[model samples]
Target: MQITPVTPDLAAKSLPVIADAFANAAHSDGHEADLVTALRHSSDYRPEYDAVAVNDEEAVLGHAMLSKAAVVADDGQRWPVYVLAPVAVTPAEQKKGLGTALVMYLETMAYGDGIRALSVLGDPAYYGRFGFVPARPFGITAPYEVADENFMVRELQEGGLTGVHGVLHYDPAFGLTPQA
Candidate 1:
């Protein structure tokens, strides 16, 4: 399988692939596909950070996105961060490392762009393999109540979160109100 940024053609094909992937997921909220649509229209959207995994035939089989975000400290300080959400892989395409390939690709892209940190609300068991750890210990908290284990963070570079800490503020496109 090949991994590449979501071009217009890939985007067109990946939307349904993404929607259907989530629709078949037992853990989805059924709104992840819609969230992707809204996020694309938001100011924080980064087209280059939206990526897909394709087959030899160039059929998109999975999708992943990283959007701009921040963490606000009690002193009103805001630190830039990236939020990884709604990674989707067609059921038939899962378990073959397609999702991991997409995520790892995003990680390389984010680091190349000098992004210091990434946060995600996902299964710790799955993300842990990528070095994700509970964000709470790093002084980061999710906007909504979430299991500490599921709300995770990873530093792209050394000391990326050495002193970073605060309530996470996801892009408004996520339909989540930022908490001060």
Candidate 2:
């Protein structure tokens, strides 16, 4: 499988792949596809961070996106961060590493873009293999109540999360009303 950036024309095609992949997931909240749609139109959206894993036939087998986010320190300081969400792979494509490949590829792009860290709400067992660890220890917290283990973060560089501590804030598209 080949991992490639999802260009504008390919964005629509990725929707179904994402929907289908999350449709039957035991832990899915059922709005992952919709979240992707909202994020696409949000001001923080970055097309380069949207990607897909394609098979020999060029069919989208998996998808992932990293978008703009922030961590607000108690002193009201804001530090930019990246949030990975809605990563999906068709059920048939699971266990073949397509999802992992897509995520790793996106990480390289984000790292190149100078992003300090990446965060995701996912199974620790699955994401840990990629070096993701609980964000709390790094002084980061999710906007909503989440299992500490499921909210993971990876520092793209040494000291990436250093001095960056606070409640995490995601894009408005995440369906959370921004605190005034």
Candidate 3:
């Protein structure tokens, strides 16, 4: 399968695939597809940060989006971050390495573009394979209450998070309210 950025045509075909991908996941909220659609239209959406894996017949097999996020320091500083959410692969394609390829591709794109860091709320075992480590140890907090181990972050380059620290917030489309 070939991984490519999501185009209008590819997007139209991938929505259902995305929903199907998460259908059986115990962690699914049943709105991942909607979340993706909302994210695509949100200000956080970046063409370079999203991609689709397609087959030889040009059918979309999986999808992922690395969209904009921020870490708000107590000093009122906002540091840029990218959040990897709702990575989806058709049930049939799961465990075939398509997800890994899509993630690596997006990471490569981010690193090439000089992004400093990225975050994701996922299983440690799954994301750790890509070098993700718990963010709490690094002073990064999620906007809402999530288990510390569930929210992870990774530096794209050496010293990427050197001076960055605080609460990481997702785009409004994620439907999460910051802790008051």
Candidate 4:
């Protein structure tokens, strides 16, 4: 599988396919489509964060994105961060490591571009292999009540998230319940 940055035109077409993959992956989890839609329309959606993996024939088989994210420090400062969301591999392509390849490729791209920290809502089992740990380790929390393990962060630069503290504010597209 070959991974490449998504071009503007390709981003438009691949989004629906990515959404469908999210829907399928989240079928039993509920709120899959909502998450997918939020990521699609989030203000942070940029071509730089969008990527697709294609086979030798150029058929898209996997997709993923990274977006602007922030955490409010205890001192009332906002620290810039990045969020990875809606990573999906075609159902037929699942278990062949395509998803992992896409993620590694995107993270490498982000690192090369100087993005230092990233967070995501995903299974710890898989993400841990990529060096993602609970955001709490960096004084970060998700807006919603999530299993601490499911909300993870990774630092591309050593100590990237160190000393950063605040509730993680994902781009508005995440559709999280408002805090009462």
lDDT of 4 by residue, 36-68 (tens): 556667666677677888778777778888878
lDDT of 1 at 104: 96
- Which residue pairs collide, candidate 1? none
- Cα deviation at 23, candidate 1, in Å, is 1.4
- Candidate 2 C-alpha lDDT tens digits along 60-84: 8889999889888888999888998
lDDT of 3 by residue, 1-180 (tens): 788998999988989998899889999999998988888899657976779999999999999998788898989888888999889999987998999999999999999999989899999999999999999988999887789999999999899998788888788889886521
**TM-score versus the correct structure, for each prediction:** 0.95, 0.95, 0.96, 0.86
Off by over 4 Å in 4: 26-43, 177-180
- TM value for model 2: 0.95
What is the lDDT of every predicted structure here? Answer: 0.89, 0.87, 0.89, 0.77
Model 4 scores a TM of 0.86
What digit string (tens of lDDT, one per residue) describes model 1 on residues 5-57? 88889988888888888886777888887888888888768899999988899
Error of 1 at 22 (Å): 1.3
Off by over 4 Å in 1: none
Residue 49 of model 2 has an lDDT of 93
Checking candidate 3 for backbone clashes, the offending pairs are none
Error of 3 at 123 (Å): 0.9
